[model samples]
Target: MINQKSEVKVFPTNLMKQKETTTKLAIILPGAGYTSQGPLLHFSSGHYFKQEHDVLQVNYRFSEAELNPFDTDGFSANVLHTLEETLKETAYDQCFIVAKSIGTIALANLLKHPTFHNASAIWLTPLLHRDDVYQAMLQYENNSFCIIGDKDFCYREERFANLKSNPSLKTLLIPNGDHSLENKEDVLGSIDMLKNVIDGVIQFSN
Candidate 1:
């Protein structure tokens, strides 16, 4: 976790010491309540680190009031602004973004910027209820992956169908899993599902 003021945590790989001209950056954008230390983001950050990519975890903080209105465009604008400001001092030749829930909203906006237009992305439990988020995913032409659970409130059969149809998009639909990708009725199943998601993220990143 990072300080609220800074809101960015950096994990640099040892390869950075080699002074390579080309650099790969992995950015993790977490949900409002879910910090980078959460299971999915934590493991994904480790994966990217082991792959020799420097990791940047954006730990955006929110008050209870802010959490309730997270679905608003104002929230998305705040996220985009925080992310842009954090990256102002960082540089990388290539970029990969992993975003969850509200973070996915930020990713959608970031995709519009020239700096991140070509970056690959992984969307976990995205807020498909928002038309802008859905439209952003639909129009993105870069390599991207999305994973969502059927039981998640944001999940809509029609919207998932539309996203699945995009050639550049790869998706995983978890049966009976909720917003956190957890299956209340089947603990082991949730674990297995999580592994599958992690595997997909690793392969897609490669």
Candidate 2:
């Protein structure tokens, strides 16, 4: 789907190019203000594409005035609307999700749909403060991973520590990194952070 402000980028695997949903798929969800074009977002999508999995990236917009990560209802509606429209024509037999920040909220809500019940996921900078996120995560039936920074104020490390016992859930904690997992003051350090993040993505998606 395409419009003035929103776009959905789909990279079909070689197999899917000839057919559809005949291969594994990776659905990417973006942060509130972060479009699917963001470095990390598309970077991960590329990884999935390289792995021979189809990719669907959602780029959407919501009114900034009414958007609040905590409230989530408006944000959720915006994301679902874009997703439903972008994916209404197809169904995937195997799908996984990669989401960041508010994207985690969107992914959590998406999990409610039967289509994604057992889909594995990768959560980046999830809003642990929101029950809908961590709570919905509990219902995830497949292996998953969550990557967050120590300096990310949106969530607490203590909340994530509680998930240590979940065998299906893997966690990566970045030092001095913020919500985007970047250390604004140390660009060099952020490279290492990015490496770790991408490594986790590769490991999880495979």
Candidate 3:
């Protein structure tokens, strides 16, 4: 199912095998404000569903109250608490993640849990400067892929080349896309980039 709302959408999958069923969950952590309703996150969910994996798009809220630096801890704590609750009841065959921006920060914490070990990920528009974000990706380099636009504010000139050293990771750089991997002046170009993002996701995930 396509994720069209700012609510946790779970596309449940069931496969009967001698009266037993199994589920593979792909948790999506979208960027703050952008949400999973956006085209990139939405189409990515479709790809997982097509592969018979249950997609869990975790929708979170961010308010002006969380704007300050101190509140960053509070916000991350909230997101972490939600993740704990989300996983308390289910046991999945293969647990995967698709996180963007702030979601990647939360995911950095999530990766520490033993439950998420060996899990693969697709990190979009990450805050590469952050120690935690890049560290987590590096720790799980073999099981993860990252995509960022060259035009994004976080795109560091000095570190980008070094980041490419990890051949296990598949990193994509959209030419003129900003944080959203979009081209505002050229609508057609933006559309093509979106398609390219989807293709990259499919290739990495599959």
Candidate 4:
């Protein structure tokens, strides 16, 4: 079943049988300007849906003034509020998060929530520049996967190395890939990069 609304879209695998078996929910959080329909998130959510997981894609919109400091606590708060309210009544045995860019800030906040403490995450091009995002990644105790491009402005070698120290965390660095994990000089290479990231997601699912 599918439901499309202003703030979010829901794709349910088995609404009637959700309570009979363990329920798996996948939440896709997009970047500031990137919508859930973007390549990475669109495909990721489709994959989760194919696997019989209920998928929720958040379509958050913010004004220019509100986004001036996209990584601020206020911005994170608004995202968190929307998420918590939208999901307050949903029932699931497991939760999975796929977050990119500013969504990573939301992921940081979600990690602290009691309901999602054990949730696994796929962080794509996270804003490691933000102290909160970095600290959350540093202290996360559950299974999580992260992918970032070496060329992205948010990418920090020292910080990436530190995150790798966490045995439970899996990190993938795309050479010459930008914030979108695309190679500006080679479209074919960018496609390959996407394939590699999807492969990581598949492995993480297992």
Candidate 5:
């Protein structure tokens, strides 16, 4: 049975719900300029990984309230701080972070911190120039996957190819898809890909 909750926490500012057994937890961070609700209600598709893991979607402070800091660095710092705090409050055997677009950038920055050394991460259309961050994540105790659409504007083929050449990093490219995977209307396809990725994480985490 899939269970769902809304607005479960209120410190770092997030509105989230869970599906399936609450044993395994995955924190999802959406792109910039979007509230937590947007990705939770849209890309998550309700059944992406519900059969095997619980999902928690979070929003940045600026997205939750109107106290705009108006700086990307500050916003990223706030988001990373919130993630760290939230992880402290949650009880899960293993933690996985799924971030999209600008959110992926935040995750990358967070990866540089020693606090997230053991948490697995998946990046969707990550937009950052720091290849070192990705390399650092590969060297961490956790596994990391980078997913990008072939048609994605930010998809630097050469860079991604280079990343994939590294045996430690996993990369998946969706065919004929955009940054949002818009061309793939088949929700089943999305679900399949997500399942495979999650399963791989579970395998590696063990």
Candidate 6:
């Protein structure tokens, strides 16, 4: 985990990098109470696409265990702003975002922001509620994929159906898995689904 800190429009931004040789880049956002290192480990162990792509895991404003207090709204805004600045600096040919749980909602919020537009996204167990922000994300034009575990407490079949009702979104269900993917054996299935999504993204980019 490569830790670095910078200021983006007055907001302190912390980031971690997992470098690879490929042109593709993945901007990862962790779930609530999680750090970039957590996602970095998961991606490094499971995401074969990383072998051909660089993974940039970002630590949101209030998600850090130490040095910051939990403030959902403020952290969300910081995530959007940080992503906007990072995109400008990196100027990647094809940028893809992968967000888990709360991170997914944050990424969706970023999508709705005018300053952060036009990026493909993958949401893993997105913590979506009945809100205008969720509606706005459903209407966004970018290619999107939402992956949910069938056994996830926060996401049920009804919720999955509701999200899939959006013609623009694609959904993947991992059976008997939870929000954290605690069922270690089920990870292969999750990885397979992720691989398929990455393959689709590659085809779309080409």
Off by over 4 Å in 4: 1-22, 69-71
Top-scoring candidate (TM-score): 4
TM-score of each: 0.85, 0.83, 0.84, 0.86, 0.65, 0.67
Worst 10 residues of 3 by lDDT: 10-19
Deviation from native of the Cα of residue 16 in model 1, angstroms: 11
List model 2 lDDT by residue over 1-206, tens digit each: 22234333332212222243445778888786777777777788888777767787776554565363345555555666766666677666778788988789878888777777778888888989888898766556678898999999976867888867677888888989899889999999998898889988888766
- For each of the candidates, the C-alpha root-mean-square deviation to the true structure, in angstroms, is 4.8, 5.2, 6.4, 5.8, 8.0, 6.1
lDDT of 5: 0.59
Best-to-worst order by TM-score is 4, 1, 3, 2, 6, 5
lDDT of 5 by residue, 12-107 (tens): 444243543355666777775544555323444244354455566766433423433334455456666666666566666666777777677667
- TM-score-wise, the better of 1 and 3 is 1
In candidate 5, residue 71 scores what lDDT?
A: 42
Better of 1 and 6 by TM-score: 1
TM-score of predicted structure 3: 0.84
- Ranking of models by lDDT: 4, 1, 2, 3, 6, 5
lDDT of 2 at 56: 78
Better of 1 and 2 by TM-score: 1
lDDT of 5 at 24: 65
Query: lDDT score, residue 164, model 6?
Result: 66
* Candidate achieving higher TM-score, 2 or 6: 2
